[model samples]
Target: MPKTALLTDLQRLVRAYGVLAGTCDHERAIVGPISREWIASEVEQSVLLSSLPAELFDTQRGKDLLAAELYSDRNVDPRSIDPDTLDLSELCRDRVINSNRIPKLEPQINCAVLVANMLLGVRLYGNHGAGVPEISHDLIVAAMLQDALEKPYVFSALSSAEYEIVDADYIKTWFGPNVAMLSYQIRDALLAFETSSDSVVSSARIANSLAAIFASRLRLTARAAGDSVVSFLGTVRRAEVVKKGLDPDSSFPERPYLARDFELAEAALQLAGVDHYALREPVENTLMIAVKDALEDETKRSRLSGRRGKAVHELHINLPVMEYYVASESSNSLETVHLASFEMMRSLEKGRRKSLSTMVAHAFRISAFAERVLGDALEPLVITLAMLHDVVEDGSAAVTGFDHSLQKIMFRFGAPIAAMVSELTDSSVKTAGAHKARMTYEQPHLISPEDQYNVNRFTELDLRPSDGRQPYTLSGIVIKLLDTVVSLEEGIRDPELMTDWWRHSGARIFWADNMRGSIVHPLIERLVIELKQSRSDPEYALKPHRVNRGRLRAGRALLETTLNHLDMYTTQNLAILSDEYQLDESQREFLIRSFNDPNITEERFSKLVLDELLTEDRLCRAMDLGRVPAKNYVTLYKKSSVPEESSDKTTLLSYRGNALRRKAIRTELGLDTPEGITALSLRHEQVLSMYDQKMSSTELKLPCDTVEMVS
Candidate 1:
């Protein structure tokens, strides 16, 4: 929604203070002060809640709804879920339908959408996070209050129809994350100021000024929040203020207001989503109330005494909000620009250097969209990259105490997120150059190669096999490759820089050329200027660092492709495994011969053993009968004595009836062999023999589900 619309409504709401403002007419017998009692009563009253109009309850994919809660279901008595202690899994597995948060209408409609997913039964609907649901009331409520977003019928942007089910995309469009979650900091600052006793020197006046600053920025940050709860609630007060300003008497205006905010806390609680609602309230609500109190205090302060004299003075009080405002108001005012001289160096187009930051910022949309399309697999990395690409260092602020080196910043502040950032940074880093450059002559300097580091007291660079957490798994390695590839693609659009870049940086020229195009793009231009530099300077310090990145990329891609082609399992073994499914003699021989292959990966060996885990197949029978093959039943670890056989029949395992089968399994599988025996080497026949002996001895045995050996 437009800030203008919110302002328009809030202006009208200025009359909320009419009685206090002394603007109301006393001649007409009008009511007096608005009491806290009125607000209190309405707090519990059957406040009319707005729901996504009936027409938009979701027919297509990705629509969200507050579903019917668990405790509300009567058929599932309290006793059913808890046989002994409490729920074994999702207690309300079969029950749940998404609806609005209004309990009075039909408490049954409240269903929690799992935090990670919003699709049909994608989650185990029952309580998974909060203690296993033993009782009905245990079901969590995912209080997403503003499911219904009201828009003017005339607004052409309103899709499908007015009051339709909010599309997931629209949910983000309306109430999405604004400014890398900047409000969180403003919120923290607000909360700190609000709770602090005015018994000290810090003025509530300062807090109030800060609040206006935050509110104004919040308004800008939330510009994209369409029909979103945040958009509605954030704008609500302003809207009411506007309405009061327009007419000090007209009953509360309805234009785009969030009626359910009081009950559902707007949509902030939905951050955890539906899977767990009621449980999250106390924590989320605490945060909400704190921020609310801060907002109220600031609003009051602004009303009493407002408007500061200077920009720097305004910034002096609220650093975070003030900084955002200043940077926004004028480009010259930005104080936190990262020094990424590499993006501009060696490129002929000194002109593009000046606009490089802005262009790159725009370019992020490409990576963002790509990751969005990739969905769960890549989104987190993309979000992390977006934050780092611009925030950490593009070349303005020097990292000292307040501004550590970009590498250190990425490693320290982005500790939890460094892995992801490192994947996308495109550092190229061939032969480790000097990465640090102090501010010189007040000019930003891009660190260059050949500068020797103080290696004696340095953080040693190493990735030996013993290094834990190295990218060892297939997925881990793949992530590394993809991160670099995408970054290379991001810089490939311009070609002229690729040519001129080769001459300037010398060996570093590879950086620009690699970033220019696909594995093959013939560069023809020699001196096209790179974006982001002054025209007179002609050459920037760095050329997008794109070439060495290309070589590294080409190398990694080939490795991935080669790995993909190798056969990890033989056809004969697969055939043997399939035969085990059918049973009898000829099949058993095939299985034995298949195991004779000289080259089978451990993964395949593990798979074969799993397949015969629960069968009565003959080969497994041979292994059980002590027909052990060489290299089979490999030992994993060795221990001491096994527990002595118990005589007590009352014990579940000591019932005595299945003793023979247990003993047979103990022999073939090596009873709790103090020495850990890997199941991987256990041939198909060995697994079957154990199952056969058990089946024959026990009358009350349950049917097996799969052959994978659990023990």
Candidate 2:
């Protein structure tokens, strides 16, 4: 209803009630005592009165009400006001209505008015009155309060016991016994409607049921009271309730202003024969067509089933060549290689549908890396071992116990291949537990490993197999090293997946450290270094040393690329910058100045960029992860605190210098090679320029002649 129309109707009703009572005072329309007495005994001051115009305040009365509450007497039993005292002359008219037949009218009306006003307040503002209006119109307040003078209406989600007390007996004393009885009947009927099997049919069905019940109850109650005005008022109010029950957004009786707007908008759309769904269909169809086109593109295709077929074809094609090499170099028969390859395909076929091809490819790649890098002595053994490496952990071959699976492999591929495969497999890996604990949603870097694991579990790196469980066979270790390199390359190909893998493996902190421990073992390191020393003395220099050195160099390059993308803390503090990262005093000053420069700091960098480039030096020093070295300036600070000054060495500055010298030597060698020198030199020059941009002039000029390539 429009506000003006609603006000007019409300004023007409109040005037009719006033005429019937032989009283027409507008101020008297306020139902209760205006003094402090109407408030509860616990209320020190009436919030309603205080919020009203200041002219309404009486200093003495306000003070008394604040100090000693209006209803301070707790034991007082309220007395009912006589109908005659209200000057309700119409009640005395025998022909008009029977006063004795009427239920408690005054208090019932008062309670209804109070309820309506409270509902209005909740509708206009939120429950906490966060958006209360600056001025409330008198007619609006009066209209809301007058809604209470009719039959009781409730929209309760209360339990039966409490409903009985509040809606029945307690209300009986205030609104009179007859009104209370009527309220009980209404409450029971509504509660029954809410729980009935029919009510569960559908929302529209339930709403129809509620509307029928309310309409019938109102009609019966109005007839019983013998008042057309009462029936009229009941119809209006009950319609509001039924309207609300039909649709929450459309039925906002509390927010009448917004409710009118919603009604008008819906009506306008209805008249125009337009709907939101109709408007959205064309846009939705267009978007779906675009998506279909994008997905249908051949270049974007990635079918796991297709890849599985390709893997099978590639495995068959590569087998004859592998068999030839095995027959020529090793004592192992060609039949053994065939049996192992067959077993590998068979083992991977029953694995996870998506990962089957990937695993087969991994086996092929690992074997190839061993051949290209580790030489003929280890080649056949590593190939056979790598093919069956994951079988005991992932294949149906693994359904049997670990030792039983190894025995099966030994019977098929012989004890040597079986032993190396056993070493490659991680026996302690709890597949079910790890899968269940995996974080499948959100970016992994946002969650710390500490949130996902206990201290013992946190130290474990799933990517690098646990070192404690090994006989450290040379072939097995070399295969595993090649495995790490392949895995790192695959991970770096997709940065997001790489981050998730690091987080899932709990290797963000210990990635390089764990690889150093597993791939570059003491025996391997000593052999490689000694072999390099005796390269000119061919009598002592073993071919395996050159292979091991190549493997070490590949591993180092992979680690460097991993470090470039991983979440290693870089400090911005001047002390840490100069001390740990090896920025000289001048470089440190330049960094500090650049950061403070308004052009760089204000215009170029956002909050996210600044946060990305640097971590607090204090936080880096406070880390306590076991076996993970502290690389921040705190270590430098600790050294400075020592009694005597120890010379600083092994900083990032020296590392960059060495890296530049190596790059220069590699570039020079590429130029010296006669295989298309033009293209190679261009590529080499691009790399040299990159190095120059990354290093200081002094570091770039470091004697490249001293850095020799060990053949």
Top model number, TM-score: 2
User: What local lDDT score does residue 571 receive in model 2, on the 0 to 100 scale?
Assistant: 16
lDDT string for model 2 (1-711, tens) is 111222222222222222211111111111221111111111111123222212111222122222222223553221222222432223222222111111111211222222222222222332233522321223222322222233222111112222222334433333334334444443443455435423222222122222322222221221112111111112222343344342222311222322222233222222221112221122123222222222344221111011121112222222222222232123243233334544564444322111101344455545544443443233334455666777766553223111226656654554445555665666465332122112111112112122322223312323332323333444544555566545543333211221111311123223332333223323233333333444445644354323344544443333332222221111112323332233445555554444333344332433322233323442343334211133322322232333244323223222223223333333433322455435534433333233233323222111111111111
Instruction: Give the per-residue lDDT of model 1 (tens digit) for 602-640.
Output: 345345533443133443454355332211211110112
TM-score of 1: 0.22
In model 1, which runs have C-alpha deviations exceeding 4 angstroms? Answer: 1-287, 294-391, 394-711
Clashes of each: 82, 1
- Distance from true position, residue 395, model 2, in Å? 3.1
Model 2 spans with C-alpha error above 4 angstroms: 1-331, 350-357, 374-378, 396-404, 427-471, 498-509, 515-517, 521-524, 536-613, 616-711
| Candidate achieving the largest lDDT | 2
State model 1's lDDT: 0.24
